[model samples]
Target chain A: MNAAPGVVAVALVTLATLLIGTWGLRFSRTTSDFFVASRTVRPTLNASAIGGEYLSAASFLGVAGLVLAFGADMLWYPVGWTAGYLALLVLVAAPLRRSGAYTLPDFAEARLGSRGVRAVCSLMVVAVGWLYLLPQFQGAGITLRSTTGAPTWVGPVIVGAVVLANVTSGGMRSITFVQAFQYWLKLTALLVPAVVLLSVWAGDGQPHPVGGDGWSMPLAAGGGQGLYLTYSLIVATFLGTMGLPHVVVRFYTNPDGRAARRTTLVVLALLGLFYLLPPVYGALGRVYAPELAASGRSDALVLELPRIMVDGLAGEVLTGLVTAGAFAAFLSTSSGLSIAVAGVLGQDLIGRVPAGRRLGGVAAFRLGAVLAVIVPCTVALAAPNLGVARAVGLAFAMAASTFCPLLVLGIWWRRLTGPGAVAGMLAGGVCCSVAIGWTLLTPDPSGWADTLMAQPAAWTVPLALVAMIGVSLLTPARVPGGAGRFLARLHAPETLDLDRG
Target chain B: MNTPDPGNPRERVRVTGPPRRRTPSAVRPPIDTETRLGGMYLRSLLREQLRLAAGVLLALAVLVGSLPLVFHLAPGLSSAQVLGLPLPWLLLGVLVYPLLLGLGWVFVRRAERNERDFADLVRGADR
Candidate 1:
């Protein structure tokens, strides 16, 4: 593939993102605007922004790659990711927005009335944010290397710089416009090429995917272990969406609890529509580009497919379009995450410090943005290539184990005490982190151990829930006196004239 | 016991007026103060919402969650064809997206209804 088009596509996406961010910055004058867009974003716009930010490199490129490489079971990744929002809608959406939290840590503080829990939550947010970010950075590296012949480091550096620029310039308000633009850009980039490619396939002859029974079946031949892995993945993704700091923060941008629920519903539809295209690319890749899987470069299957199937300017254009989408995926997701992490860091870590207190809210946030991007970019450049989808899966597992329990229990369980929240978070966070570290640092081929370590959500989530409930029961006296009032606020409709204090 | 303390000169004027009714203002809904009735209202809302959420998740579990086990138990399903593609391919890939969207829509509609009903009940009581 000629590098010129790919280079131009990347440049265009970067320029568009920066321009949109700057445009949004003009309206972002207050601290509230920087954090939650002054709680004025409508459902459709917020949903689009959420979709843009939520569909990271994992969804954009990794899903196609995994589908190309693995058989039918890999389809669960996309399904689980989309279904996550369903879980979010049914459970966490309205109450979380009503909590009036600027970030996950803020939610913890509001619910538990404990600075200790808030501090712990802030740490978890940064950890999950960075874990999720590593893959986006890594995916960017892979994308740039394939498209523009750049070194792996170049991609992360450029993406990190772009994210920092966008986040610092406009904060949440600016990134909302930038990310909403990205959703449509990404959709067009994938959809147009997919339609054209499908027609091309039909024109030639719609050949069936060449695979054995396992490729077509959900879990053919692989027995108990495969079932465990699949279930673990489902648990992680279904429960974890609510826990993702960037995703949850988007809800706070909605005008109220009702809009938040509406936004989530729209997100589900948007994600469902977007997810349909990746599998098409994946299935087509299986038929047209099997060598990609064999060569261990299936992650590039989406970018490489158009060029391989067609041989002309049109093919180059399709490649350019997909590349632009992939780049936009990285930019939008990274900007959202950086804003989320920076909000926490600015308020909890920096603002609490003597020198940091002297800096204004925006300045502290700008510094936090720089700190947030640099660490992940550096780590991504240093870390060996973990498959993009798998790394993201680990992050989901971490979130499911940690924040899922906190959010669910804290919102619904009035008896939940601060001690219980702290204990649950620590237990879940520690166990998941250990499991992730073991899985990443040491590759164990042992059967059950490997599976359990690789997909820890099944056990970790239960442990977290049990710890929270049990601890809360034991420490009944420690439950906050304002629990009833908080529950009233969380459960009541915004239309009701409640004090909510 | 009836005599007021001389050190505290403020009048204890509780003589003859009928006890004032504690009518909470509309601006400050009773739920905020967790009155017995208000607490009941909040709990009822929470219960209804939780049930709705549970119902959605159960449907998800039964419909989507059991597929892997079903396929694993009966491997022959893999060979079945639909639209010239294998059954698993169609079920997992193309069809599941719409199913998910439908599930989400159903949940949202029902949940919002529950909230609206709760709001109406509360407002009716306030009136």
Candidate 2:
């Protein structure tokens, strides 16, 4: 494949992202602005930003690839992802905003009033952020390799540098604009090609895609295991969205609880629209390039489909467009994740350092950003290529297990003591991490072990919730005295003139 | 002036009727009930929100959770063609997104309405 179009596209995307970030940098000065865009972002823009960051390489490339490989069951990936926001909107969004916390750790410390709980939450946030970032780096590598025949490492290095630059400079304010722009770019990149491809298919008499017997089935061949995997996937995705570190932090940008809720509603619509196009690629790929699926390069289906279906300049241009979108996806998501991780590290780790009290807020955050990106980029280089969607799913499982319990219980139950929160998080984190580690190391496992390890959310989430409730009940005296006031603040509308303080 | 002792006793008697009642204009009435921070009031609001969320979750659960069972029991349904695509293909790929959006729309509307109702109740109680 010629490298000019792809290189130009990638470079253009990088330039645009940096330019936007620098432009937004003017508005980012104060600590609040650095952390949550000064909590002044309106709903539509925030929703766009959320959609942009949320639809990562997993959504842009992974969904189509998974669908091409696994057929109908893979639909669960997108469904679970989009529906996760629904869960967020209903259960977490308003209350979390009302809680007046900037990050998950902030919420934890405020709710449980324990240094230990905050510490655990900080650690988990880092873990999940790294886990999520690993795939993005890997996906960038894959995209670059396929498009330009560059060494695999180049992609991760370039993406890491760009993300670091954007995040360290402007923080959340810059990322919000960059990500919002990316959402539209991604949608257009996919939508225009989908429309053209459909027309081409119609012109060519619309050949039917060939799918074998089990392709359309919801479950895999192993009857019981398949059921387990499906349910586990449901459990993970449905509960996990609220816990994602980057996603939860975005809600804090909303002006108030109502705007936060509104942002979520718009996000659902935006995601729903974007999701429609990927399945189109998947379905069409089944007809046009089934061999890619067999050869295990189905993840490139979205990138390669336009060229396969169209001819000459049009195909090349379309390919360039998609390459740009994919690059944007990597940059946007990596920046968001980096900002989230850096914020945590800055506040809890670097900022806490008593090194002559020299490091200021921006300096601490910049240092944290470097640490956040470097570890994941290095890991991506060392680790074997886990499919992007699968890796992200594991991250979700981890989040669902840990933060989901923390958020749900912290908001609703006044009896959630600090010790209980710590216990629950540890239990969930350990269980999910073990399963993820086992899967990553083993590569291929069979029988019940495969099903259990691959999708740990079903068991792990319940374990976390149970541990939290049980431990809280056992140590009722440990419940924070301010729990009642906190609950009232979280649940009441902003219109209510309550003494939240 | 004519009866200083009698006048002093009468003034003390007039001031003794609960200071709050004596100067109702000077003191604003306590709005604790309107604040909705009382345990019962807070509980009811939480319950209302939880109920709305649960109802939305139930709808989503029933719609999505049943797909595997349906596909398993009636394998033919998966293969059946709809809109020139397999039933599963059309449903999962195309239709599910709209359904999710609709459900989300309904949930947001109801949730906001619940909040609105709670706010109104608090304001009414204040009056």
Candidate 3:
């Protein structure tokens, strides 16, 4: 095949991920181990894995793209994505770990004492999982179609295959190892090229930032739309980080509440350090690849920047490395989402089966893997025109609206009854879902509602919280009796017994 | 006093004190005593978690809520240019994330410290 260097790089990365997953399978044994590595993952390793999985196609490629388009304003995506973890750490992570549940649905059932709430959580998990998955598939499609003259469907198919293979092989135990490895790969890919490109730009007489006739000022160029977009982004990134299923599931891998909190701290540091680089790439892109700024395809900003600046064999090598890293982002994130969605769906829906059915469990999980990967792939392919970064932002918004509020109320308030939980979820879910649905369906959609629909987290989160509080307070008698005790389990220090299992 | 009889491993486990209490009748195993005490201990722990979670969430809510206000207040930012973007835009847009990271880090560190302290207490009591 006459593949672009990117195609070859992506292929090699996929192969590596497969090999690693196969290797990870050797350590797997029981169901608990599959879901959460038997809850014994230490802080350092867990943090590395979280970083790996967390740095999705958005982080790898979208950051530079946002920067290229919006200039300094785009810096918020990386910052918010990173900092969202703080919310997770303080409000949900340690307690979530303490809940001893394998998935979000599990947490919901335990906390709210309602099968109904778990069911609502189950549906949202799949929706958010699919929304998050859409970008990974889209990024893959972009990578493939850009690099090779193949059909766009090829991108989603290839990523879907790799994700299915890895997720089916080892689940969380396997994914953790693979993600840790990919984090380093992503770092190296971006770091090495960044250093070389800076030197190249420096040697070529160091062009001034803001390039030629383009507006370099943040909203000066973007105008009113800019402020709207920026704050919208902040809301999405900050809150959306809390609701992401893949990221949340990682907390379950910690040995106990304390370990989970430590893991979050490490995640914050790793993310902060990683985020420092993307802005440099964007700033550099401004000077090196001016056309990306002029045209609106800054999403392709990072890929094109190196080639625009570098030349000959060196450019090819650098492009190849970046391509691999981009592929790593797609694989790690898709795999993480696929596993999380699959786990939740498989357990809550499928596991309630005839007893002693080992084959049934594995098969159900595998089927869920396919479902998780395919839905996003289809959605991404269907909506071929979205900016990858913007699409990913939508996913964050929906998550923030739905999961962020659910978790916050569920964990902290003893009086959050099942009916109240359902009401809040329905209100938040309907509004956000309608907004997302409208945004997706309406081509040529524009203006404030469009912006709000496109980024509903800011409004929807508060709406949900209010609804949850209002409904809960009105019918306080239905609150679960063990809410107090269960809350304690989530907050208490871990004993070695909890760690051992 | 209460200690674990270990007669029933699944449900009944000793939580505090020695095994028996002096009574008029033959002494009953302190199983009920430990279970009740354990229940109370567990409730307190949950209360602490709720307290910590609310504290962190409220703080984040404030930080996130203030972005538009803070950006409006910043000097020399032209509503025009700050950080290569609008002051309000950057605050609402890009600033929220690093703020997220900062807030997330603070919450997680404090939470972990809380958990760590709780764990130490548990370990200490065991000893």
Q: What is the clash count for each candidate, in the order shown?
A: 0, 0, 18
The regions of model 2 sitting more than 4 angstroms off are B1-37
**Native-to-model Cα distance after best TM-score fit, residue A156 in candidate 1, in Å:** 0.6
Task: Write model 3 residue lDDT over A440-479, tens digit each, in one string.
Answer: 7878867777767766777888898899889999998989
Q: Show the lowest summed lDDT stretch of 10 residues, model 1 chain A.
A: A213-222
Quote the positional error of residue A465 for candidate 3 in Å.
0.4
The best candidate by TM-score is 1
What DockQ does each prediction reach against the true complex? 0.48, 0.29, 0.24
The worst-scoring run of ten residues by lDDT in candidate 2 chain B lies at: B21-30
lDDT of 2 by residue, A1-501 (tens): 878778989999999999999999999898888889999999999999999999999999999999888878889888889999999988899999989998999999999889999999999999999999999999999999888889999999999999998998899998899999999999998899899999998998988778766765667476778878888998899899999999999999999999998999899889989998888888889889999999999889988998899999999899999999999999988988999999999999999987876678888888999999999999999989999999999999999999999999998888999989999999999999899888877866898987799899999999999999999999999999778778878887876666545
**Across residues A25-88, which tens digit of lDDT does each residue of candidate 1 receive?**
9999999999999999999999999999999999999999998888788889989999999988
* Residue A429 miss distance in model 1 (angstroms): 1.3
Residue A423, candidate 2: alpha-carbon lDDT? 91
- Chain A of candidate 3 scores what in TM-score? 0.94
The value of fnat for model 1 is: 0.78
Cα lDDT, all candidates = 0.90, 0.89, 0.75
> Once superposed on the true structure, which residue ranges of model 3 sit more than 4 Å away at CA?
A1-4, A211-215, A221-228, A353-359, A441-447, A495-501, B1-75, B78-109, B112-127
| Candidate 2 lDDT for residue A200 | 94
